[model samples]
Target chain A: METKMVISNLLHRPTRTIISILAVAIEVGLVMLTVGMTTGMLSETARRVEGIGADIIVQPPGASFLMGFTPAPMPIKIGDLLEEKVEHVAHVLPVLILMNVGVGVNIVFGINREQFDAVTGGFVFHSGGWFTGPDDIIVDDLYAKAGHLKVGQKLTLFSHSFRITGIVEHGKGARLFIPLQTDEELNQTQDKASIFFVKCTDPGYTDDAISGIRQFLPTYPVRSMAEYTSLYSSNNLPALNTFIEALICIALTIGFLVIFLSMYTTITERTREIGILKSLGASKSYIMSLILREAATICVLGIAAGEVGTLGARRVLQSSFPTLAVRLTPHWMVYAAVLAMGGTVLGAVYPALRAASLDPVDALAYE
Target chain B: MEPIILTSDLKKIYRIGKVEVPALRGVDLVVPEGEFVAVAGPSGCGKSTLLHVLGGLTAPTSGKVLVDGNDFSAMNDADRTRFRRHKIGFVFQRFNLLPTLTARNNIAIAQHIQGNGFNPHRFQAIVEMLGIQGKLNHRPYALSGGEQQRVAIARAVICEPKILLADEPTGNLDSENSQIVLNMLRGLNRSFRQTILMITHNPDAAALADRVLRMRDGRMLLD
Candidate 1:
C-alpha cells in the first residue's frame, strides 16, 4: 500500500516526475558515456598494440608510455645493435611514430616492410598488399572504413600525398603505416626511430631479451608485451582521470539538485496529504520513508533509462565514427548507478525531514 | 460507562507575532464510552480547535486531556502521536483523502500506519457497510462528496480506534449526501457501539447525535 501510494503520488504529477527522471538520467548518462569513451579508446589502443606480436618494446629515455606522445629520438642503429648483441632476439623493427593533428588526432607509424613483417608475423591484408612506393601508405580496415577509403585512394599527410596500397585487418600498432625511409625523409630525421618492436625467437625468451636490452640501455623504457594492456588504465593518465572525476562531480551535482528541488516541491504540494498521514498516526520515520522511497524509485528508473540511453549513444557514435570505440562495461555502470543513488537520496533527506516535521493541524488547515 | 474522553479547563493560545489569540479557553468536557456526541458552534467558535486538541493534533496551552485512559497533556509529542495511532481516529470536513490513492488504498494506509497490516474481513465489512465496496478502486476525484466522506470514515475506523473525532464530516456534502453520511455515522454508532464525537453547525446533523453540546466564544455553553 505504501509503495502504491508513493507511485501514485509520482504519477499524479506526470510532468514533474518525467522532468526529474530525465534530469537524473542525463546525469548518469553523462558520467557513463564520458568514462566509457576515454577508457574504451585506451583499452582498444592497448589491445591493438599488443596484437603487434612483439615480445618487448624499447623506447628512448624519458619517453612516454603512450607511443603517439614519444618522439623519434633514438638512433635506428639500436634495432641492429639489439639483434646482433641480445641473445634470443629473433627480429628488431625500429619504428617512427608521427602524431597527426590534421582532420583528427591520429598516430602514423613508419616501418621497413621486411623488418615489420618479420617482427609482427606479417599483416593480414584485407585488400591490396604492402607499400609499392615511398609515397604509398597502408591503412588498417577501421581507418579505411572511417575515411571511406579504398585501395589506390590518395591520402594526404604531413603536407605530402601518399597512395593507399592496402587495407589491412585492424589490431596492429597503428592505423596508418608509411615506409620508414619516406617518414624519416619527410621529418628530416634520418636514422632516428621513436621505438623498437623486439620479437623473441621463443615466447619464453621475452624476459631474457628484455634483460639483455636493459643491460645496454639501462635508462630507456623497456616493457614486456604481456603487461601492455594493464598500462592503459586511468591511473596511468592522471589528467584524464581528473577530467573524469570533475565530470562525475558535475553529474552528482545535477542529480542532487534535481532530486532536492523535486522532493521539496512534492512535499509542499502534498502538505495536506502529509498531514492526513500524520493524523492517522504515521510516525516521523514513516513519512520520511515515503519521501525517500519515492526518490529512490525515481533514481532506479533513471539509472535504467541512462543505461539504455548510453547504449544507444554508443551505437550512434560507433556507426558515425567507426574508429571511435565506446566500451560500456558493467563495472562503470554499477559505479555510476551507486553514485547517482547516493546523491539523489542525500538530496531528498532535507525535504523528507521537513515533511515529517509538519504539524498535522496546520497542514490539514492548509489550503 | 466511564468517560472515554475527559478534559478539564483545557486552553489553547495561538501566538502570531506577539499577539496571543485564544482558540480554546478553559473549556471542560466529557463523553462516555460508545456515546455519539455532537459539538455545535458557528465558525471560529473553537469547535475544530477542541476537536484538534482532543485528537492530539495539537497540544493544549494548559489543562488535562485524558482519552482512553491516556493523559494526552502529560505525554510528549512522540508519545502523543503513538497514542493517537492506537487510540484516536480523525475525519476532516474536507474529506481529506490522499488524492493520488484509490479509495481502498486510502483506507488501507490507516491500517498500515497502525502497523497491523490489512485485514480483508474487516476491510470488506467496513466498505460494504459504508456502501463504498464498488467504489474502492476509484481515486478521490472520481468519488462523490458523500462517497469520499464515507471512505474517510472507513479509514478512521479501519484500525478500530477507541474514539473517532470528526470535524464537520458532512459539511461539504449536499442535503441528500449529508443525510446518507449522517445515517452511516448513526449506523456505525449503533451497530459497533463506536464512540464518536462530531463538530458541526448543522442543526439536523447535530440532531442525529445522542447528545448535543454547544460552544460560543471558545467556551462550552450549558444545554
Candidate 2:
C-alpha cells in the first residue's frame, strides 16, 4: 500500500517526474557509454597484439607514436641489429606500415615466409592456399572486392602486376607483406625495414629479448604490447572519454537538483497527508519509501528511454564508421541503471524524511 | 474498566533560540476503551498538541503517556510509529486523503502499510457504512468535501486500531454533511464499540462525542 501511494504521487505530477528522471538517465548513460567506449578500444588493441601471436612486442624508443605512421628514418636498422646480436631471438620478421592510406594505396611489409610463421601461423585460406610463386601474391580483401579481382586474377598493385594467390585477413596488420626479396626489388631501395618483431623460442625469454633489442638498438624506442596498447587507447579515444565523463557529471548534478526541488515541493504539498500518515503509525522508512519509490520509478523508466536512444545513436555511428561498433552491453546497461537508481534514492533522502518527521500540529496548521 | 490511555502532567514546549514556549502545560488525562470523547479548543489552544502527544507524534516536554498500558515516552521514533500504526487510527481536518488515489485505494493503503493485503469485506463494509459506495473509484479531488472526509475516516478505521484519534473530522463539511459524518461516526462507535477521541471547536460536534473537554492557553480546562 505504501509503495502504491508513492507511485501514484509520482504519476500525479508527470512534468516534474520526467525532468528529474531525464537528469538521472542522461548522467548514467554518459558514464556507461564513455567507460564502455574507452574500455572497448583498449581491449581491441590487446586483441590485435594477441592476433600477432607474440607475447612480447619490441619497438624502438617512441615507436608507438610512429605506429602505422611514416617518419624520416630511425638512426638504427632494427631488423638487421636483431639478426646480428640478439641470440635468444628465434626468428625476427620486419613489418612496415603506412597508416591512413588514400584510396588504392598499397601497404608493403618485408618478410620471409619461414620467418613470418615465427609469429603468425600464416593465413587460413578462405579458398586458395598460401602463396607459392614469386609472380603470385596475396591481395587485400578491400581492394580485391572493390576492383572485382579474384584468385589467379593478375591485378595492378604499385606499378607491378601480381597474381592473387590468396587473400590475407587484416588480422596480421591489414597490409600486404611480400617477401623481403620482392619488397627490395619493388621499392627499388635498400632501406632497412622500420620495425621488426622478435619471436622467442621460450615465452619466458620474451623479456630478455626485449631488453636485448633495447640494448642493441638503443637509438630506437622499444614498446611492449602492454605499453603500446595503453598508448593507443589514450591517443585514439581520449576526447570521447573526457566528453563522456563531463556529460555524466553534469547530467547527474542536474538530476539531483531537479529531484531535490521536486521532492521538496511534493513533500510540502502533502504536508497534511504526511501528518496523517504519521498519525496512523506509519514509520519513517515507510514514508521514505513513498518518496524514494517515486524517484525509482522515474529512474527506471528514464533509463529505458536512454537505452533506446543510445542504441539508435550507436547503430547510426556504426554504419558511418564500419570497423567500430557502439556495444550497448548488458554490463554497461546494469551500471547505468545502478547509477540512475542510486542517485535518485540519495537525492530523495532529505525531503522524504523531513516530510515524514513533520509535526502533525504544525502541518495541520499549514494552509 | 481500565483506561486504554493515560497521561500525567503532560507538557510540550517549543524552543526558539532563547525562548521556550509551552504548547501544553501540566495536564492529566484518561480515556477508557469504547468511550467517545472530544477535546474542544480554538486554534493554538493545545488540542492538536494534546492529541499528538497521545498518538506519539511528538514527545512531551515533561510527563508520561501510556497507550493501552505501553509507555509511549519510552519508545523510539521507529518503535513509536509501529506502536501508532497497529494500536491507533487517526482522522485529520481538511479530509487529508491522498488526492491521487481513488476512495477505495485510500482505504486500502492503511492496511497495505501494515504489510497486509486488503480485507475486501472490511473495505466493502466501510464503503457501505460511510455511504461512499458510489465514490469508491473517485479520486479525492473528484469527490465532494463530505465524501472525501468519509473516505479519510474509512482509511483510518480500516486498519481496525484499538483507538481512533480524530482531529476535526468534520471541520471541512457544511452542517448537512457534518451531521451526516457525525451520524456515521456514531454508527461506528456503536457497531464496533470503537474508542474515539476527537478534537473539534464545534460544540455541536463535541456534543456528538459522549464527553467534551475544553482547552485554553495550552491547559485543559475540563476533562
Candidate 3:
C-alpha cells in the first residue's frame, strides 16, 4: 500500500518528479565523468611507462611521473654511473622529455636512437625509418594521421621546420621523438637529461636492479613497472586527489540540493494528504518510510539513467577525441551510485521528519 | 449497559499567542455500545471540537476521555495513534479521499494501515452495502459527490472499528446525495450494530441517528 501510494503520488506530480530525476541524473553523470577522467589519465600515463619496456624509471627528486618538463634535470653522467656501478643494469638510456608549449597535446622526448633501442626495443614503423639527421623527427602514426602529416613532410617544432622522417606504429609511448643532441642544444641543457630509463638484464631481476640502482641514486624516485599501475602510483601526480575530491564534493552538493528542495516542497504540498494518512492511523515511522521510499526510488532510477548516459557519452568522446577516455569501472560505478543515493536519502530526512511530526488535525484542516 | 464512550467534564481551550479561546467548556458525554448518536450545533458551538477530542485527534485542556474503558488522556501519542487505528474510524465532510488512488484502493489503504490485510468477504460486504462496488476502479475525481461519500463510509467501516466518527458527511452533497449517504449510514449502524458518533448542523441528518444532542456556546442545550 505504501509503495502504491508513493508511486501514485509521484505519477500525479509528473513535472516535479521528472525535474527531480533529471537533476539527480545530471549530478551523478558529473561525478562519473570527473572521476573517470582522473583515473583514465592515471591509467594512460602508467601504460605509456610500461610501453617503454623499461624495468624502472628514475626521476629527479620531487619530479612528477606525469610527462612534462622536470623541475630539475639529472646529469647525463647518471646513466654512465648506473651502467658502470649496477651489475643488473642491462642498458641505461638517458632521455629528456619536454612538454610542447605550442601544442599542449604532445610530449616531445629527446632520445639517442641507438641507446633508446638498446634500453627499450625499437618500434614498428608504419611508414618511414628512424631519424637520419638532427633535422629529422619521428612521430606516432595516429598523431601524424590526425595532423595529416606523412613521411618527408615538414613539421613545425619550436618554430623550426623538421622533416617527419619516421612514423611509429601508434604505441602508448610519447608521440614526439627527436635526436637527443638537437633537443639539448635547443633547450640549452646539453649535459642535462630529464631522467633515465633503466632496463634489467632479466625481467625477473627488476627488483634487484631497482635496489642496485637506488643504491647509486638514493635521492631520486625509482618506480618499478608493477607499482606504476597501482592506485598508489596516483600520488606521483601532485594535486590530482584534491582536484577529484573537489569535483566529487560539487556533485554531492548538486545532488543534495536538488533532492532536498524537491522533497521538501513535495511534503509541503502533501500536507493534507499526510494528515489524512495520519488520521487513517499511519504511524510516524510509516509516514517517514513512505517519503524515504519515494526518494530512494527516484534516486535509483536517476542513477541507472545517469550510468547509461555516461556510457553513451564515453563511447562518443573516445571515438571523436582519442586522447580523452571515460573509464567507468564497476568499482567507481558502485561508488557513484552509493554517493548519489546516499545524498538523496540524507536530503529526504528533514522532510520525512516534518511529515511524520505533522499534527493530524492541523494537517487535515490545512487548505 | 456499560458506556463504551465516556468523557468526564471535558473542557478544551485553544491558545493563540496571548488569547485563550474556549471551544469545549465542562461538557460531559457518554454513549453505550451499539448506539448511534448525533451531535448538532451551529458554527463555533464546539461540536467538531468534541468529536476531535473523542477521536483522540487532539488533547483536551482538562478532561478525562475514556473509550472502551481505556483512558485516552493517559496514552502517549504513539499509543493514541495505535488505539485510533484499532478502535475508531473517521469520515470527514470533504470525503478526504486520496485523489491519487482509485475508490477501492482508498478503502484498502485503511485496512492496510490497520495492520490487517484485506478480508475479501468484509471488503465485498462493505462495498456492496455502500453500493460502491461498481465504482471501485474509478479515481476519486471520477466518482460523484454521493458516490465519493459512500466510498468514504466504506473505508471507515472496512476495518470494523469499535466506533465510527462522521463529521458533516454530506456537507458537500445535494439533497438527493445527502439522503443517499444518510440512508447508507443508518443501514450500516442497524445491520452491524456499530457505535457511531456523528456531528452535523442538519436536523434531517440528525434524524437518522438513534439519539441527538444539540450544543450552543460549547455547552449542550436542553431538548
Best by DockQ: 1
The whole-model C-alpha lDDT of candidate 1 against the native structure comes to 0.92
Put the candidates in DockQ order, highest first: 1, 3, 2
Candidate 1 per-residue lDDT over residues B146-220, each given as its tens digit: 999999999999999889999998889999999999999899999988999999989999999999999988999
Model 1: how far is A304 from its true place, Å? 1.0
B-chain TM-score for every candidate:
0.98, 0.97, 0.97
- Candidate with top TM-score is 1
Pick the lDDT winner. Answer: 1
lDDT tens digits, residue span A206-313, model 1:
898889999989999898987756799889999999999999999999999999999999999889999999999898999999999999999999999998999999
**lDDT-based ranking, best first?**
1, 3, 2
Q: Per-residue alpha-carbon lDDT of model 2 for B1-223, expressed as tens digits? A: 7799888888899998989989998878888999899999889988888888888777778887889998977887788788888888888777877778888888887888776677888888888888889989899889898888898889888988888888888888899999998888888999999999999888899999899988898988988
Q: Rate the local accuracy (lDDT) of all candidates.
A: 0.92, 0.73, 0.87
Count backbone clashes in candidate 2. 9
Worst 10 residues of 3 chain B by lDDT: B214-223
Measured against the true two-chain complex, the DockQ scores of the candidates, in the order shown, are 0.90, 0.54, 0.85
Q: Ten residues in a row with the worst lDDT in model 2 chain A?
A: A97-106
Candidate 3: clashing pairs of residues: none
The reply for model 1, stretches above 4 Å from the true place, is: none
iRMSD in angstroms, per model: 0.7, 1.6, 0.6
